[model samples]
Target: MCVSAALLLLAAVSRVTVAVTLPPHTYQTPYHAQVWSCREVLATLMEQELLGCSFTIISVHDDFSAALTPFLVALMITHSRPYQVVSVGGGDDVRPAWHSTSCDVYVIVAKRLLVLSDLLDTDDDSWDWQGRYLMFTSSSSANDLQRLAVTYKLQKTTDVLFFIRGTSDSELAVYTHKMYSKRSLKLLTLWRDGGFVKMVDLFPNKVNDLRGQQVRVLAVNHAPSVFSIIDHLGLLHNVSGLDVKVVQGLGRALNFTPVFHDPGADLWGSILPNGTATGMVGQVHTDDSEMGIGNVFLTEVRARYITFTVPFDFERACFITPAPRPLPTWMAVSFPFTLNVWILLVGSVLGLTVLVPVFGAGLMVRDYQELHSLSASFLLILAQFSNQSTRRPARTPMQVLVGFIMMCGFVVSVFYSSNLTAFMMVRAVEQPYTSIRQIVQSELQVGGYSDFWLAIFQGSANQDVRSLSQKFFRFDNVTKFLQSIISRQGVLLENTKHLEYLQKTFLTNRVGESSVRLMLEECINPFGVGVMLKRNSPLKSSADTMIQRMREAGLVDKFFKEVLQEARGPATQLSSNTDVGAEGINPLTLQHIQGVFLVLGGGMCAAMLVLVTEKAVAAGKYCL
Candidate 1:
C-alpha cells in the first residue's frame, strides 16, 4: 500500500509540475506575420470567452511550418489551464508518425511545416483523428489535412481555418465529425495581415451558427428530402458516412422550427400580389387587376425555401410586326381635289367664253385655246386609269373638258387611296410569335408579370399541357375556387391531344392571345414566378454566397450555355419567344399617361399657333 501510494504521488507530481518550453523561436520572415496573427486573434477572442480553450493544431512540417510552429506552441501554452498540441512528421521516404503531449504550459516546437502536400497522406478513416484548429503554411498538402480535419470533426473549436497553399485542391475533404458533429465547417482563405474582413462579408453569421448547440447531422440516401433539410440545418456534409435511415431518424427526432413570413413583395420588391408569389402562402384567387405575377417582392421570404441569385444575362422580348403600307398620295390631299376641282376649272373656262364675244378674233382664239386646255385635262384623267401618258392642258381649251378631267382623276385617286387605307385598317399583320413551349423545351425560364384572363382560360381548360416546365409565374386576379383547383386539382385525361389543340387554337385566335395563353395556361406567363426572399434574411446571404461564388467561378454561365445548346439542338422551337425583358412595374397608368401626354402636347401646340395667328391678324398682315 505504501509503495503504491508513492508511485501514484510521483505520477501526479510528474503530470502537474513539468512545464514544456519551446526553443526561443526565430520565425521565417514571410510567414511570421500570419503565424503571429493567428496567435493574437485566438488569444483575444478566447480571452473574451468567445472561443473554447480546447483548440489544437496538428502540424505537418516543411520549411514554412517551422515559422508557424512557434506560434501554435505559444498559443497552447498561453491558455489558463493545461492544454495539448501535437506535431506530426512525414515524407515520401518515411511513414508519417505523431508525437503527442500534455503540458501546463505547452510550447513544443516542430522542425517541419504543414503544407498542401501532406493532404495526400490522409485516409478516409483518419479524418476524425485530430483537433479542430489547423494551419497549413509550409506546403501544398495542408488543404487536404484541413478538409479531413473539418470533415471528421477533428478540429472542432476553431472558428477560422487558415491555409497558405503552394498547391491545393479546392475539393478538400474534411472529417467534420470530430471538430463538430453538427455545425458546418466553413473553409476560407486567411491572409497574414488583416483579410478576415473579406470572409466576414461573405459569411457574417457563420460564427453564430457554429456557436449554436451541438447537433448530429446525418446524411440519408433513402429519404433525400428529409435528410437534406436536417443535414442542412445541422450544417452537416451530405458526404458524411451516416446511412439514409440514420438521417431520416435524425430528421424525425428534430423539432424543426417553422419559418414565419409576412405578406409583401420579396427583397427586390417584386412579387405577384396574388399569393402564388409565395409558396407558403400557396396559390390565391386573384383578379386580373390585382398584383399578379411579376410584381416585385422584398428578398427576405424567398431565401427560406430556395436560393436567389442575380441575373447574369439580360433578355429581350419584342413583338415583331410588318410595317404599315403608305396611304395613297391623292387621299392625303384636300377633299375638293376629288369632286369640285374639275367643276371649278370648267366654270372658269365658260366665264372666259363671255369675253370671246367682246374681244373678237383674239378673244375667240383665247377661248378656243382654253377649250383645248379643258380637253387635255379630261384626257389626262382618263389616261391615268389606262396607265397612259398624262397630257398637259393647253393655255385656252374647252374649260368644261379640263374641269371634267381634273375631277375624274382626283376622284379615282381618292377611291384608290380610301379603299386601300380601309383594308389596311383591319389587317392583322402575321408575325412570328413565340410562346411558353419554346421557352420550356429550352429550360431557360426568365422573369415577367402574369396575365389573368389567360390564366383562367388555360388553367381550367387545358388537360394535356404540363405546367411545371415553366419556372416563372406572373400573378393576376384569380378566383379562390380556381386557386383551390390549381393548388389541389389533378386530372388524368385520356384524350389529351384533341383537347390541347382545340384549347390552344381557340385561345391563340383571341385578341391579346399571348396574355390569354399566359393567364389560362398558367404555364405561359408566370408573373410572380420564381422564388423571392426578404432582404435581410440570413438565408439570402447564405444563398448569395454560393451563387456569387458559383457565378464568379463561371459555373452558372456554363450551366445556362449548356441548357441553351441542348434546347436549340433539336429542329424544334419548343421554348421560343418566352422572354419579355425587364418589364416596368406599373400595374396601371402607363397607357393613360401616354394618351394624356400626346393630347396635351397637341393642344399646347394648337393654342400657341392660334395665339400667333390672332396677333398677326390684329397687326393687319393679311387682308384676304
Candidate 2:
C-alpha cells in the first residue's frame, strides 16, 4: 500500500496532472484501496485514469445471461472524458450492437472461455490496440492473467478480473444478478467495492456517438481562415478569424479534438498538371490527417481528387489594384467636352462669320471711314464672339446684326467659365482602370498568388484575360506587391479574405491611401470554398452534416460578424463612372480649345492668300 502511494506521487510529479471532470465518486486512502478485493483495485485504477489520464476507456461484454456481466457494466459506466467502452463477443457470433459499436475494452462473457494460450495466439489485427486505459472483467487464473498481460502489452500489476480468492461470500453469491420470472428484479446501482450501481443499463459512449475521438486536422496557414502566427517563443499558432472559429465550433459539436498540422500555405493543397494531388491533399490521401480546413475552394479539378464538405463560404475571385493616377496634362483643354461638341462649336462659328457678311455685306454699313477688308471683318467677328466691343459703322442694319452676335458670345463665355472652375480648384484625375477590360488595356502589370489563378487566366479565351495573362507579374513578396499597387504600378488578383486580411494587418504602413482608396470589386467568378479531406473519408460526411447545422442555426453568420471585422472605416471612393468624387470634376483649359484656335489661324491664312491672288489679277488687268 505504501509502495502504491509512493508510485502514484512520483507519476504525478513526472507528468502534469490533467484535470478531468469526473462523475461523483468516493476517494479513499491507499491502505483501504490496496487491501480490498481485486475489483476494488480495478475500480480505483479506473477512477484515477478518469480523473487525470488524457483518455479513459472501459469495455463491457454484451451477454445478458452472465451472472456478473451486468454488475461489471454498471461499474464501468461511471466514467468521463477520454473514457470509452466497447462490447466483445464469444466465438459463436457477434451481436448487432456489438458489431456496429467496435468495442475497445470488452468484459468478456465468452461462450467457450479461452485459455491464456489461446489469448496469446490471438491475432493482433483482430483488435485495434491503441494501448489506452484498459480494464476488463473476466474469470481467469493469475498465471493466465500475467500471460494475457504480456501478450497484449498491458500492465500485469493491475487486476482485470472480478473474482478474488479469500474474499467474502458476498462477492461470489452475486445478488445483483438475481432475477424474477414472475416480476422484474429491479437493481438500484447494485454493486460493491465502487463502480456504477444503476438499475437500468447506461451506455454513455454509445449514446454519444463520437466518443471524443481525436481527429488529426490540417489547418492550412491562410490569413482570415487559419493564419499561423509565430510567437516570441517561436511556436506557431492559428490566429485565423472566422474559419478557425468555425472549426472550433464544429469540433465541440462533433466531439472531436483537433490536433492541427500546419505545413503552411505554400504546401497547403494543389492539383498538379498531371491530375494528382499534392500538399495537404496528399497528406490526407496518405492518411497523415483526416481533413484540411481553410479557404479550400472546391474547384472541379480538385474535386476529382479531394472530397469537400458542404461549403461554408462562397466568394468571388477579385483583384486588389493600385490607387488612381493623375490624368494627362496635355489633354486638359479638350478633356471637358467630347470631340463631336468641339467640331460642332467650330462649324457654328465659321457659318455665322461667313453669313454675317454675305447676307448684309453692302447694305449701307459699308463706309470708307470704318474697316472694310476681310481681315477687319474677321477681327470684328472675333470681338463679337469674345463679348468685347469692336468699331463698326453707325448703321441700323449693322447694329442689329452685331446685337444678335453678342447673344451667342454670352452663352459661350458662360460655358467656358463653368467648365474651367473645377480645374482651377482641385486638379485631380479619374482612375484609368475602372474595369477588367480597362485594366488589361492599361500598361500596368497584373498578378497575385499563383495558386490556380494564373493558370485560369492563361487558359481563358477572352481577349482581356489573354492580355492580362501576357502582362501578368507574379508577386514574389506580399509587402512589396501591396506597396506597388498603392503606388499605381500594378494590379493584383486574390481572394476576398486574403485581400481584406492584408488591408487591415499590413496596409497601415503603406505610403498612401488605405483599403477604400484601393479598389477590389472586379471579380472573375465566385467559387465555393469548404472543408477538404481525402476522397471517401468518413470525416467528410460528419463535417458536412455539422456545417449545415451551423448555417441553419445562424452560428455561421454570427462568426462572420465577430471574425471578419474588415469594415475599419467608411469608403468615400466611388466605383461607377457617373459617380462624382469629392476632389473635383475634370476642368477644361487652353489645351482643350486648340481645335477652335487652329481653325481661326487657318481661316486667316486662307483669307490672306485669296486677297493676294485678287491683287495679282488686278495688276495684270493692263495686259488684258
Q: Whole-model Cα lDDT per candidate?
A: 0.34, 0.53
lDDT of 1 by residue, 456-537 (tens): 3346344323442234344332222222222322111111221222223322222223211221222322222222322222
Error of 1 at 325 (Å): 14
| TM-score per candidate, chains pooled | 0.26, 0.53
Model 1, position 86, has a per-residue lDDT of 49
- How many clashing residue pairs, candidate 1? 119
lDDT by residue for model 2 over 227-246, one digit each (tens)? 66655643347455567778
- Name the lDDT value of residue 512 in candidate 2: 34
By TM-score, the best candidate is 2
Runs in model 2 with CA error above 4 Å? 1-214, 230-235, 252-259, 273-276, 328-335, 362-409, 435-444, 458-463, 466-474, 486-489, 503-522, 536-542, 545-624
Worst 10 residues of 2 by lDDT: 1-10
